[model samples]
Target: MKQSGNSKQFAKKDGEACPRGRPREFDTDTVLTSASQVFWNHGYHATSIDDLCKATGLLRGSLYGVFGDKHGIMLAALDHYAEGSVARLAERLNAPVPAEEALRNALLHYARVACALTGERSCFITNTTLEMQPGDEELRTRVAAIQRRMATLLAASVIRGQASGAFNSTLDEKAVGDFLLCVMQGLRVLGRVAHKEDALIGIVDVAMRALV
Candidate 1:
């Protein structure tokens, strides 16, 4: 996985300890990055505690002591990825460029990620949703909330585009946002099998034209 450029923003001061543990020697953000990469590379079910331990360079005792259990760690990882993704979206949408252009750039950015040469080449939240069991309401709820936040950001951009006459003013902003969300998710799913950036770009072009 690409090391998060925002790691330092989330980094704990060195040597912070969990509620009931020795002082932590490892950086928490760094650990999560590694753990998230492991989860991203391997589905939740296929991932083992040993894999996490090896990836994070922590012993099982340390992992459990810090995160409580594998599930806790997974939640932490999800939060880590989700927070970064939403923050990046906000940054992109808030850029000084025309809103329509920002939206296009955002779509193209994620489209490229969907076809990345390494990592999962899919949204972490989407991957988690697919692996979540029916009984996993908490997991489902978390994913749903994150997706909703993403949709809201997209909707805001749509509204901006409409204000600037870059998009159809008659269209419902929320519905358009939802439509884009579906397209972005579809790109990730299709990219996994096709691994084709050109195909993903074609979908993005369709999405952009639809907004216009």
Candidate 2:
């Protein structure tokens, strides 16, 4: 019998070939979250569809049916990560504390979390940027936009700090914001190599001093 393109064969418990059904009722959000964690741990180039399936507890057909492909799932995962991260940062920025102090605390929190993670250094977005291929123009563009948003938030905080006399007005707000982003990225890379949390915290502390 001729095999149909849409008719995929899956193995049953007893090892018999079964025709794949209408796909499983997997939650896309849950799957994306799981997939994001997997990518966070293993990174984009290192992570495979098999890894995503294992992480999400879904079969290959189900994963493909829901997410289309590895890139599709990764895009969804990136979106999920960006949303959560931006929200957390915004919350930190809006804290009742002084703007400079709040920004420092936020950076310290991020550094501590990055150092605490067992599997990778730095952030998934940062990791993806380093691993992105030339063909990944769209993904790179998205990453750039996220970075810009982060910079803008940091800049706004710096502006507020200047107004409140928390940070010195000598330094340009935009420059300080850009510097903080670079420092955070540097700390992420350093954390991947060094297990010492103090090293990461030191960077933030010094940056905080410079801001004040």
Candidate 3:
């Protein structure tokens, strides 16, 4: 029998504490990513300070020192998520292909991710929108801004489709973008319980018909 086993020492010990004597020395973006995941899995109100501290591997004091508070970290995480999502959307919507094709690619990408793994997670923004109270100004603004950006990006693609004669020219680009945005969000929500691929594909087809 061959004795081939990798050493477990290379892995950071699970209970290992953060290195002390170095303030703001850790990766901020990485912390935000970890913090975002905890918040995404559990809404802001439900997620405790201890939850974030454990997720980010930082002490409670350090977290407050760096991020001001839990809400601060949540905002940073939301910003990080929004920025990354918009960048990805721009890439997909701006692909060098027919507008309709690009839109299909984007929608398919969303569908694939939605159905991936357990498919229990929906978009963070969508979840936050429902969880946060309407009086939450900062949260509302961030989500609204992200939605607006998505609409604009999709509308740009719609315009291209119209110009290429691949999509209906008479349809309002912004309106179409809004419709597709709704479809995209709905698809994500529906994917949680839906296992069949064709069901989601059919939804895509129906949504695409608006453009055609």
User: Candidate 3: what lDDT?
Assistant: 0.78
TM-score of 1: 0.84
* Alpha-carbon TM-score of each model against the true structure: 0.84, 0.83, 0.85
Q: Put down candidate 1 lDDT per residue, 1-212, tens digits, no spaces.
A: 32212222223422333444434356778899888888887978889999998999776666776677888899889988899989998998888999989998898887888788454636677788778999988788889999999999999999999999999999999999899889878877777777788888888899999987
Q: Could you give the C-alpha RMSD of every candidate to the true structure, in order shown?
A: 6.9, 5.6, 8.4
Q: Write candidate 3's Cα lDDT for 1-212 as tens digits.
A: 11111122212322333344222346777888898899889879889999998898766666665567788889889998888889998999889887888899899887876777355357787778778887889888888899999999999999998999999889998898898888888778777677666888888888888677
lDDT of 2 by residue, 1-212 (tens): 11111224233322323345432354667777899989988888889988987898766765655456888888888988898888888899879998977998889987887787653646888888778898898798888888888888999999999999888988898988899889878777777777688888888889999987
lDDT accuracy of residue 195 in candidate 1 = 75
State the lDDT at 179 in candidate 2: 95
Worst 10 residues of 1 by lDDT: 2-11
For residue 158, what is the lDDT in candidate 3? 91
TM-score of candidate 3 relative to the true fold: 0.85
Stretch of 10 with least lDDT, candidate 3: 1-10
